[model samples]
Target: MTTALSPVDPDSYRALMAAHPGGVAVVTTDDGLGTPYGFACTAWCGVSLDPPLLLVCASTTGSTLPVLAGRGWFAVNLLHGAGRRAADAFAHRDAGRFSAVPWRPSPATGLPLLPEDAHTAAECRVHRLDPVGDHTVIIGEIVRTTTTRGADQPPLLYGMRRYATWPVP
Candidate 1:
């Protein structure tokens, strides 16, 4: 069960959110005719284990959202420290997001994917889109996954206004 609450203090909410470490990821999609689009995201969440669902939140005003709308397919690249440049480049509104990065298609899913060196990547077929507050929740069914480091590599993490990681000891 859940309870209702008053409007949050924006500053306090921001601070609280910053305290929580989030794994960095980049969501990408293409028009399938050469035009590609994507953005850096940290709001990825797994929704279900039975149906293999994943969720990602994106702003309505973002550049990639338009291209992704109703496309029914996308790829999520989990970033490591080496992917910081990729994350920054995709965060912009330029039309050259894919061109700036080296990428290829997933063999199993035929979805456009990043090069083999990312920590991991997943190809997803979108299941639904839900609007919540200032963002849209993108729900996708994970069709295939490819990984180089699996759980062994330390992922790029963001917390308290910076990037971070804690290697397994």
Candidate 2:
């Protein structure tokens, strides 16, 4: 049996998804052109644990999207509460995304990784690629992972049109 469905506008679907809160991440990789490209992404999620997999979505029109799709390895840097500016810088259409931040190359993936971010970083190798709608769904196998209770800083949250911080309890 098939279920009938109504077509929803793309903008409406985006708005609906924006209503849900998601953790922000910076997906970075070397373009194999002697330059590192990064972008702020809120579409990152954990896909599995057995083989250690994670997923991040990239828009087809984004400049770094093609580089990421073709690259075999990449890094995911989870931002902390104070990383809103860093996130905005990378998310924009400028070339200074990696200029204002202090990041280093991942030892495993050779991708740029934010050393000061909430201390959460992952180096992954592309495992699967699925074209869905206007974005590509990338599933990566985690080759390396790091996390530290370095600071008690709250996390940066994006919802609606504003940035927020978690309340202290």
Best by lDDT: 2
Residue 84 displacement (Å), model 2 = 0.7
Report the C-alpha lDDT of model 1 over 49-84, residue by residue, as the tens digit.
989999999889887777787567888988876677
- Candidate 2 lDDT, tens digit per residue, 6-61? 98998998788788777778888888665888888889899999999999998877
Candidate 1 has an lDDT of 0.80
CA lDDT, every prediction? 0.80, 0.81
TM-score for model 1? 0.86
Q: Show model 1 residue runs off by greater than 4 Å.
A: 1-6, 108-110, 149-152
How many clashing pairs per prediction, in order?
Answer: 0, 0
lDDT of 2: 0.81
TM-score top scorer: 2
